[model samples]
Target: MGCPLVSIIVPVYNAERFLNETLNSIKSQTYNNLEVLVINDSSSDNSVEIIEKFVKSDFRFRYFYNTTNQGVSHSTNVGLSQCKGEYITFHDHDDVMLPSKISSCVEILENNTELDGVITIAEYISEDGSPLGTKTALPDYITNNPFFVRAFERSYIPTWAMFMRRDIINKLEFDDNIKIGNQDADFFLRLLYRRPQLYYLSNPQNRFRQVSKSLSKKSTSTCEIYKKHNDVDIAKLYTQAGYSKVVIDYALAKANLWRENIESALNYIISAHERISEFDEEEKDNVYFIYATCLYLNQLFEPCLEILQKIEGKSFRAETLNNQGVCWAIFGDLTKARDYFESALSILPEYIDPKNNLFALNASESMPVRHFTKFPLRSVYKTI
Candidate 1:
């Protein structure tokens, strides 16, 4: 069979620093039947000049500039409306596509006619292009569950990791109003409602640059798209579409927690606990951590400690210890708190939570003590 054409939609903002490397990586992809739709969102930097250079030298690279600074969702939709490839994917202007990424995904789609799309794993990179590590592993149930179930758990499928048939473009568009930095997650969740079949490929790796000030981390509210769908409750819509109840609750809890809606977060997490038995050990630990966090925020220290103590796996053990230390400190047992903080540091020397807690403990000798509180969300720790 002849090679199928692939279209890559790249949304550019002020990405001049990494734009050249990003485009070069695409140009060097092993798969050659490709069209690059570089949508420039009126970048203030010299990103437009760099894009023009690639367009001039390569037949496959095409550039389109927005008249004004529309956000990523609008730019992505523009590329979606114009792209003519048999297969399509999205890329960020600052991230790199590994050499075999396109070819690997296309090969699987060609061979497995049942899969509507494929998602590959990614490695995290520093701004200087230093490799940090692989992104967190997906839950083990990803392969067998509906794509939305996995998407609900953590929104694992970013635009950069996803490759799909052009048909998906006709069914969905990026929500132009989703400004909370989870536009990709909103798009994927809506797509999952359509029940598209997808596969996760572990072999091909993409480089996802972890910007410290990325919008997702800095944005406090959940995406607007999740608030309503035709005025129907989003959770109700997903439930009608047959998504797992536990995952849906857990996801809502996380969203509410991000907005600091501690009461709502606690409510959703309690709902999740009704079917907590369905979760695997690690997944259960995730729910427990969120539950404990909500309790901690509500100042239910003893209940939070009880839940934190049930989490046994090493993945969250250190954070649990750090949180327990915070509870002890709040209860005015400085010695016990110090011991817990010290134990947490022993387990994870580089962990910032315990280190900060220990410092606070030491500083409290004469000055008024100010204790730090830790809330573990998946792999990230939020200290307050």
Candidate 2:
């Protein structure tokens, strides 16, 4: 039998810089039966001409342009409306799909009758097309967890990395209301609510281009997504899935912290503490660190120090010590703060934060020592 047709949706908006490379990557796909839908969201640049070049050359490539500059979600919805294929996936105009991406994802869906979708890990690329590094997702862990649970952890799966049955569009569509960012998160969360059995391949099938204007820079939208889902219904869903309420609350706290809403972050972390038993040792340490950081940021130094004293794990030992030092300095004890900073340095001599703090401490005997609270605790949790 011939290969089943696969529809790839390309949403373009002033992406002339990367349009040729993106379309070329799609054209080179190993899977021949493809319907490439290029939706131009009113590009003021030469993106339309670049898109037209492909449309004129290839019968499989179809181009559509929006009159007004609709958002990515709207352009994607328009592509979804027109695509007719056995499998479909979204491709950002600025990103490049590996030549075998379509073939690889289709092979999995073709073989796994029980799976409704396939998502692969993605390799991150710089704006100049050089390899920056991979994302924070550990393939073994992320694949084991439910997509719904993993959605709250961190964004690893880009739109181009996911391939699904065409029928999913029949049931779900992009939320055009997500104006700023987190469009993929909101859409995937809604998709996970229907409980689609998805397969996550360890091998990366796309290169996600990271530019200055990428949506990941928008922290306010991330805060909005977390707040929008902090209700009892979302919490209950996680609990039913065997994840604890603490998970949701901690995520909200982290989200609020990103946007520098210290009071809200502190409140959410405090709420997370109410069911802290649900977390394992590592997760507990993460929560404790965030709790302390929130308190420290909110001027509740006493309780923050108390929380810091309770952390017994080596996971955040350096960060905890540095924060404790800052608290001491704020309390008018420069000597004690210096000792704590030295302790952190002894534990991690190469650590940047504590080194900076220690240097600042030695420079002055004044209060308010330089504090460093960069905690990369997002991917630390194992699938629970």
Task: For residues 3-64, write the lDDT of model 2, one tens digit per residue.
Answer: 89999998888898898999999999988999999999888999989998999999999999
* lDDT score at residue 352, model 2, on the 0-100 scale: 77
Per-model TM values vs. the true structure: 0.83, 0.80
lDDT string for model 1 (88-171, tens) is 999988888899988888888898787788877788899888998886555322243343544544544677878999886575
Per lDDT, the best of the predicted structures is 2
Score candidate 2 by TM-score against the native.
0.80
lDDT of each: 0.77, 0.77
Clashing pairs in 2: none
Which residue runs does candidate 1 get wrong by more than 4 Å?
Answer: 136-142, 178-180, 211-220, 223-261, 271-280, 362-384
